[model samples]
Target: MNGSLRTILAASIAAMAMTGVARAADVPIVPYVEPVPVGGWYLRGYIGMSNQQLGKLDNVLFTPGTVEFLDSGGFDAAPIYGIGVGYEFNEWFRADLTGEYRGKASFTALDRYDFNGDNIWDGSNDYSANKYEWLLMANAYVDLGTWWGITPYVGGGIGASRNTISNFQDINTPNGGVAYAPSASKWNFAWALHAGAGWEVTQNVTVDLGYRYVDLGDGETGDIVGYNGLNTVNNPMIFDSLTSHDVHLGVRYAFQ
Candidate 1:
């Protein structure tokens, strides 16, 4: 009686253990991972071209005792490039602090003048120089909603620039004269308005192509002198309302 009872109890316990092991193996085990969201710091680099203009030039008439003058003056196109670090505050907002090197431009003015209102001698002079600037700006932008992987944007910047004038020369053919203005540099208040679209090529990279209208204030030269019979000692030559129309192409690398 004792052996039969003990054997039956042991067999029942073994059967229950095997059943529990089978049930445990059949249950699935998978790890749960949360998805990450987007928004982070970025680095940007840009290269562009500027079509520049000199609004007005003065001090050309100082030597002729009220030398009345007529002139055509302008600045040539040049290249500009910059690097920046920025933050994407969200899908709709961003900002950057950038420093740029604006390439040199050729400046020329064809001056037609009469000394003392004399019709006897009508003469002309050409003034030339190379101008360049270094700019630092803080810019903020709004990225409109993306359409077809491209986002339209609008923005503005406020900054300062060091405008430099170099290689200043004056040539007068009629009077067989030559003159020079001292090359100089000036600090000016600068601002810009930007507009364009950005194409999101991948999750962490974007390409931006856009336009900017920048007002670089004014630029000037030191003093001047004329050779031969032409007028020499004059006030500093002024280039007022200096502005540029710029087109930019840039790339951004974003970090998460």
Candidate 2:
């Protein structure tokens, strides 16, 4: 090719390359965006404290007017630990299955009896025991919208509770009496209502702080027997309307 023709072609190629560079610099660059997941499975663990209550005590041996309570039965506060597996369907909904162990709580009460319908108390007995529970639940929750990486939620659960009564004693205040009942466990219907807030700690981790009101049905002891093998009763003592209010802290790890 001629030198003049070659030089003209080279200039044209360099001008096209410079124009391409200028256009590239003028075009805007898009910022990187993080994607949100639609749904996921998660594992959770929790620890909590429970304030327990017992409505009353019942015994078949005690007639309506013949028995009176000097002190109503009640339970002390207890600690709780739990683990669960869950599915988060969206930013606003989730469900889980949980199992928990409630630590033992001390129980106390005092009562008097009138064998004859005289309305006068013949004698009194002081009751003492310890109780614990194992609870399993299926729960669903509706999460309110997130604000500053924290989401509040409300939920409910239905399940079963294994309530246990142990170390039950009836101390006769009139005499130095020692009557006792064996440890017993009963399975009962259980339910709970939950309210909480979850704070996002990482991309796949959330920390939860919550409160729960739970109904654990009833708990009971085995048949009553005297410590000296005398004056045994045929009926068990029942703890009616067992319930609790709980405060919990937990963490959930989502599988992405």
Candidate 3:
């Protein structure tokens, strides 16, 4: 009886070991996966085109009833370049500080004056100038989401602009005396609204295409002086509420 019992016990242990091995073989092996990365520092560079605009020119000589604008003042489209360093706080938020040099844009306008408020025009002034700016801003953005390797975003910025006016001329039409204003610079409050999409090119690189609308408060020139050494009081030429619509193509590289 002792020998029979020992054989049955040994057989049962072997059968249990075999069953455990078969169960292990029936289970599938899981492959390892990489986790998505988030939060990193980035460097950016961009080039863009600016379509600029200006509000009406203001001068004491041309009071409300005394000036009739034949052609309102405006600026020609110009090129823009910028660079910035930014931080991605997460997958859906980021901020940056940027500095940019706005290329010189030419300005032109024409206006007729009725000095005595008589609707009859006495003469017209053909205005011309070149304008440029140094813009610095602190910007923040919200990334809506990502799909097909592309991310869309909306952003805003608040900052300052140093606007410079150069080569300003008022050509008094019809044999009238010409006036000139020296180059001058002014600091203005600036703000912007941005919308864009960024395409991922690599694990650490992206290409951004964007549109922006910016307001550069105002710009002005030095006191106007006549060509023949005549200067008048309160003669500065004011460019009210300068603004621009900009399109940008940029690249960003992340440091991981």
Q: Which window of 10 residues has the lowest lDDT sum in candidate 1?
A: 60-69
Please state the error at residue 48 of candidate 3 in Å.
0.3
Query: What are the RMSDs of all candidates, in order?
Result: 6.5, 4.3, 1.6
lDDT of candidate model 2 versus the reference:
0.94
Alpha carbon lDDT at 85, candidate 1? 96
Better of 2 and 3 by TM-score: 3
| Residue 237, candidate 3: C-alpha displacement in angstroms | 0.8
The true-versus-predicted C-alpha distance at residue 99 of model 2, in Å, is 0.7
lDDT of 1 by residue, 1-256 (tens): 6999999999999999999999999999988987655578999999999999888777755455434446568888999999999999988999999999999999888876656465654677788999999999999999989999999999999999899988888888887878887789999999999999999999888999999999998888877766543454566788888999999999999997
**Which stretch of 10 consecutive residues in model 2 shows the poorest summed lDDT?**
226-235
lDDT of 3 by residue, 47-73 (tens): 999999987799877677888898998
lDDT of model 2, residue 109: 95
Which prediction has the highest lDDT against the true structure? 2
Error of 1 at 231 (Å): 9.1
Q: Please, what are the lDDT tens digits per residue for candidate 2 over residues 126-245?
A: 999999999999999999999999999999999999999999999997977788999999999999999999999998999999999999999999988888866545888999999999
Quote each prediction's TM-score. Answer: 0.80, 0.88, 0.95
Q: Which stretches of candidate 2 lie over 4 Å from their true place?
A: 1-27, 32-34, 231-233
